[model samples]
Target: MRRNVRVAAYAVCVRDGRILLARWTGAGGPRRWTLPGGGMEHGEDPYGTVVREVEEETGYQVEPVALLGVESARRVIPRRGWRRSAVDHQAVRVMYEVRITGGELRSEVDGSTDLAAWHKLSSVGLLTRVPYVDTALRLWRDRPPTGRAMGSP
Candidate 1:
């Protein structure tokens, strides 16, 4: 198996009892709601990455207020084509609490996410979403002093 690692940043923007989410259309899976952020560019700071991703996905300029926590997940993906080996995938996600600074709400065009919208925090579970959404929210709500989610390594 081949090992693959990805590090990405995400923002949890909450206002008026709602959370901002972008509908991810990548990964060739069903579209699902996720935080408005993504992988960093080469040599890019995670702080800059979160700001850039949020703007690209949701048309909002955001300023990260605090570093909430970091979460890591690992999984195995079987080979998809001939001569390819199974992949041991690990994702290191950095979560931040951000506040919107400017820009109108709009969907990204020809990007990984198609739609951006605000959903009530209480009703988030009713929608189809990526697991990252919940994990990130927990980090935001819990705000553990250690900067790690409860029970997380």
Candidate 2:
């Protein structure tokens, strides 16, 4: 079986009891909320990648405070899009707790995500979110030792 590993970074920015999120519009699925970040480019620093992706997706400037955790998932996806064959995908996701230092909320143009907003943490349950959202929140709250990153590229 063909296989590929996709590594990405995400931010959990919480301030004043609200969490910052970007609305991800899928190709065939309903719009769902997700953390503000994306895949790291080749030769790109993860820190720089997170900064750029968050800005691109949410229009907000963020500073990564601490690494919340790492989440990984694997699944079989028909790889006709990248023009690759049927394959397995392993996503190693880096999660961080970030601080929103600046910028206004705006919609990302011609991107996978469109809207960016701050929702009450308590009310986040009512909104449809990607699974990683819950995982990030739990890692942020639990603060387990195993969740801490030693040093990630």
Candidate 3:
């Protein structure tokens, strides 16, 4: 059995009690609201990836303010559709909380997302945010772990 893994970066751009989100139009024709970010390029830092992705997708410059958290999803893929084969796939994503530094909001003409907007924090749960968005929000809402050094004597 072979497994495929994908690493992606996402940003939770929050401002004035709202969070920036993008509407992702998938190949399957389903649209989903997601945090502003995307996959990391080869040899690119995760933080940089988030900044570039946010700018590219939302046309806003963002600076990562905090390291939120990481999430992973694993799924089995059929080698063939019903009559075909099977495969294994896993997707790992790192999410961060970012603050807008500059630039105005504009959608990229050639992008996976069709729209970008800020949604009220209180209404986030009511919308169709991607799974990682919720995870990132939870991490942001909760303070990071605090303790002594791992190997302190």
Q: Pick the candidate with the highest TM-score.
A: 1
Candidate 1 Cα lDDT to native: 0.94
lDDT accuracy of residue 31 in candidate 2: 96
Model 3: lDDT of residue 147: 17
Compose the digit string of candidate 2's lDDT tens values, residues 1-153.
688899999998998999989999987799999999999999987788888899898888889999888988888978576656888999888988888789888979999898999999999999999978888888888887899433322
Kindly list the per-residue Cα lDDT of model 1 for residues 20-61, writing each as its tens digit: 999999678899999999998889999999999999999999
Clashing pairs in 3: 79-85, 79-86, 80-84, 80-85
Over 4 Å off, model 2: 79-84, 148-153
Superposing all C-alpha atoms, what RMSD in Å does each candidate have to the true structure?
A: 1.0, 3.9, 5.0
Sliding window of 10 residues with minimal summed lDDT for model 2: 144-153
How much is 19 displaced in model 1, in angstroms? 0.1
Higher-ranked by lDDT: 1 or 3: 1
TM-score of each: 0.97, 0.89, 0.87
**In each prediction, how many residue pairs overlap at the backbone (N, C-alpha, C within less than 3 A)?**
0, 0, 4
- Model 3 poorest ten-residue lDDT run: 144-153
* Ranking according to lDDT, highest score first: 1, 2, 3
lDDT of 2 at 117: 91
